[model samples]
Target: MLTRIVTGLALIVLSGLYWLQADAIPQSPMSGSVGADGLPKLLALVLCGLSLIFVVQSILVRQPLAAPGIPEDDQDEDDAAFTRRGHVLAGALLAISIVYSVILPYAGYTVAMGFLLLAVGVFYHRRMSAGIATFAILGAVVFHLIFITLLGVRMPEGIWPNVLAFLHAHTA
Candidate 1:
């Protein structure tokens, strides 16, 4: 509970900082009514709200009645395994994030995002399939349309422009 509260407080501070940074973004004439800062500000608010809820939920939840009696002997082993798994998963996710950032500029948003989704999905599901591939492709396309086409953000073109040029030439 103390940890949860502390984490929530830290998140609140982080969200405040994020909101300030978002507020600092310069206004552009090309921006929509919501402006470029809209999304970041909204995200910061959402994070703060979620953190508050987390802190409250942690405080309200009662401790597990001392397991109703004597604890099982495997408890320590189970905790150790759980902690180890958590660390491994955290490390794996961090590695994925780093790779995504490194590749984003060269791969373009669509391709890099697809790779991120596929990699994360495979990591969690522990398997790969046609379904995952389709999801990744479709997800990337949808996100590309939302952020680039609709929002008009100037994301990296990377290898996609060349591919698109070749395809258009062949088709034409």
Candidate 2:
């Protein structure tokens, strides 16, 4: 709980700094409705809100604070279990991330990110479900729109470009 609160507070500070820097962005006459700093400021605000929520949620959970540098014999069951599980959980996340990076060029950003999200969801929930699948797909689509459509970044195409062209031609 303390760790969560501290992390949240740190994030809140980081977001505030981000917002201040974003505010320095100059407005352009040709800028659209959102403007140059719009997305950055919005992201900072969202980060601040999330950080506040994290701090509040951590406080609400109210876990007993564990003392640091406790002797191995004095360590509690919860701490031991968490320590034991941390390696496995971190390993799973790292392995999945490696796989994502390896397959990204072949799978494309959208598909690879969707797979990553799905894998993370499964890791956290310990099961596969329709809701996780939907979230992964929707999240991937939103990311694709933000990076590819709005920002006009050139990502590894794999099959996406061909697929998009086919859809566009058919729709037209």
Query: Model-by-model lDDT, in order?
Result: 0.89, 0.90
Cα shift from native, residue 23, model 2 (Å): 47
Q: Write the per-residue lDDT of candidate 1 for residues 4-25, one digit (tens) a residue.
A: 6899899999999999999999
lDDT of 2 by residue, 4-121 (tens): 8999999999999999999999999888999999999999999999999989988886854456954433356767546657878778889999999999998899999999999999
- What is the TM-score of each predicted model, taking all chains together? 0.49, 0.47
**Model 1 clashing residue pairs (backbone):** none
Output the lDDT of residue 120, model 1: 90
What TM-score would you give candidate 1 relative to the actual structure? 0.49
Cα RMSD of all models vs. native, in order, equals: 10.8, 13.2
